[model samples]
Target: MNYFVFGGSGFIGTHLINLLSKKYPNSVVYNLDIKENKQNGKAIYINCDVRKSIELDVPITSNDIVINLAAVHTTPGHPDHEYFETNILGAENVTAFAERHNVKKLLFTSSIAPYGASEEMKTEITLPMPNTPYGISKLVAEKIHMIWQIKKNTERQLTIVRPGVVFGKGENGNFTRLYWGIKKHRFFYPGRKDTIKASIYVKELVNFMLYRIEMDKTDVEIYNCTYEPAFTIEEISNAMMKATGMKRTIYKIPGGALKFAAGVIGALGGKSFGIHPDRVKKLMISTNISGKKLKDSGYKFQYSFDEALKDWYKDNDNLYLK
Candidate 1:
């Protein structure tokens, strides 16, 4: 068996590559990415852009698995056209290549962004109402991959995992910024102390991917990847402290004052600081995504909120706040 992973040099993809290497020692692993892996994985890296036609000379059998992780996922970072261009086009290109090569198994990582920002719990049955360019692009990309799977009736297998905020190793996103904020004693609560942030650790995410791909009984399997109830801001902060042995005096600041301060900080020192005035509203908005579908599938979570933090803290994270 051969594993072909597009955009495998990225955060989640790197972890997937590492796991694939260990689990299938004899199997060849090919990572088609624009850049090389920074964490030293066993997968051979090949520079290939997914937005256009993907050309490679690797031997691929019909049994080989192809995972599409290539996309412009960062919100508020890219222009509207960039997201559609990379995400939508990449999906079209990747699925087309899979079809031509007769690759039966395909995996994709879609985000909970399609459900949009909501305090209400959203499940697989919920209708997608994406608001941002990133969310809209991801939703479209999911549909594109779905069409590929459905075209073959029962012959093609596709697994779509809609994850919330994914954090781990090389992640430079929300969790990493929060960790740095708490460590520096600069972080403070904006409003409601219990805002839910649906999330999953990278290791658990990839492990679940491996589990689901083999266990999927249908031609297409779609499930949410997040903690069942979601983690409250307080819960996440406390876990971060306990895991890293970091001490910070938590203070509650008025939303306006916090926003002003965040604006100044974000302006003075880019997104690296984690706190931005424009993003302050998100701290209070609850993203209550339901993971019941995955939980009911008999896949036991290997790490709890605290355990995931402890593992990430111990690893010292590959990117940002290093």
Candidate 2:
């Protein structure tokens, strides 16, 4: 068996490649990305950009599995066109590769942002109302993959996982920002602590994807990947406090004040401090997504927020001061 991973140098991709290399020792792993992944010695690095069409030097056989994890996912980072260029076009290129090679399985990691910023619990069947470019691009990418699956019909397996804010060690996203603040005892709620932030641990997500692939299910399976009973800001803060044994006063700042500050920062051309107006707005919105489908499929999550936080702290203890 061979594994071809697009965006293999990324956080989730790095972890997934490591797991694949260990699990399938005999399998050849190809890491395709614009940048080289020197971290995983076992992976064969192929310098390729997904925004354009992919041309790999290695031969892709029918037995190979293609996993598309490439996308311009960071909100408030890139322009709208970049999202479509990378995500939508990247999906097209990946699916094209699968079609050309007659690959049996293709797994794609999409974002829950496609369900839009909603307070209500969202399932896979829910209609997508993507507001942001990142969200819109992801939804379109999923459709592209679905088109490929339909073309192949019963012969191919397609797994599309819409994961919510996935976090763990080495992750430098919203969770990392929160971790930095909490570790420094400078974190606080911008508004009500009850704002839901549905999330999943990276390790558990990778494990589930591998498990689903091994099942050899010949059909399209779309899952909203997140931990059960979506976590709130207070719950996450409490877990972080408990894990690090750092009990600091967490104050609630008014949302208006935070937004005003963000506006001021934006006006001043300030991208530092990790508080952009768009990010502030996103923080205020509840991403209450449901993982019931995955749960009902009999997959048990290995790490809870507390366990994952504790493990993360252990790995990054140097970043914290007593």
Candidate 3:
């Protein structure tokens, strides 16, 4: 089988590529990344941006399975337009390419961001109330997949995996911020530390995606990908401390005060708070996601918070990124 993965050099995509390469030793895997995956020599790397379609050295065909994992994730300092171009336009290009080549299956890795930032528990049925362009883009991309699916009239398999905050080695998401800060013994414990984080580890998320692909027979499916049990921010902080074997002072600020301060600071700057706005919001509320749909698909999460943190810390000893 021929497998094509977009953004194969990214945190989650890289791990998935490694796993797929090993799982199907005899199969050919091509990674379409803006940057090459030097770590994985087996994948044929193509340098191109998914936002604008480009001709591939190797043409895609009906037998190929294309997985689109490229997007401007929710992060600090990124312009909203960037998210639109990459998340929506890039997705369109992937679906177009799949249809043009008559690809068999296309898996899109979306986010739980579309479900909005709220203390309320979320399920697959939650109406998407995306607060940021990052979330809106992901939601729009999912729609594009459906649009293309209907137009093509081909037996194209589509699976949309909406993952929560993803973290692991080489990750740059919310988890990275906490892990790095804790590693330096300069962690910030915003709010009362009781806030729950809707999070998922990268390895398990990748496993869920692949397992769904293996088991899927339908034309379209959507699943929320997250850990079985969620953890509180306080629990996570403690786990981080235990992982690093270091004791540090945690500073707690009132949630309401922090939110007010973030708004004032953002107004003063004529822009969104670089990092504090999102952080304060997360610290103030519980973000819970249900993964029952994915869990029922016959996959089990084997890693705990402490174990994931320890492995992540050991792998990235530098711990600090400027």
Candidate with the greatest TM-score versus the true structure: 2
Considering TM-score, where higher is better, how would the candidates rank from best to worst?
2, 1, 3
Question: Model 3 compared with the native: what TM-score?
Answer: 0.87
Model 3 stretches with alpha carbons more than 4 Å out: 151-154, 256-277, 314-322
Instruction: Identify the runs in model 1 with alpha carbons over 4 angstroms from their true place.
Output: 38-40, 269-272, 317-322
Compute the lDDT for candidate 1: 0.86
* Candidate 3: Cα lDDT at 78: 92
lDDT, model 3, position 245: 72
**lDDT for position 197 in model 2:** 93
**TM-scores for all predictions:** 0.95, 0.95, 0.87
> 205-275 in candidate 1: lDDT tens per residue?
99999998776454788889998878888888888777777778788888888888888878787656677
Candidate 3 — worst ten consecutive residues by lDDT sum?
270-279
- Computed on alpha carbons, the lDDT of every model, listed in order, comes to 0.86, 0.86, 0.78
Give the Å error, residue 67, model 3.
0.6
Clashing residue pairs in candidate 1, if any?
A: none
lDDT per residue for candidate 3 within 166-260, as digits (tens), equals 88887765676675566554345655777767677787788777777776464788888776667888888787777767677777866677667
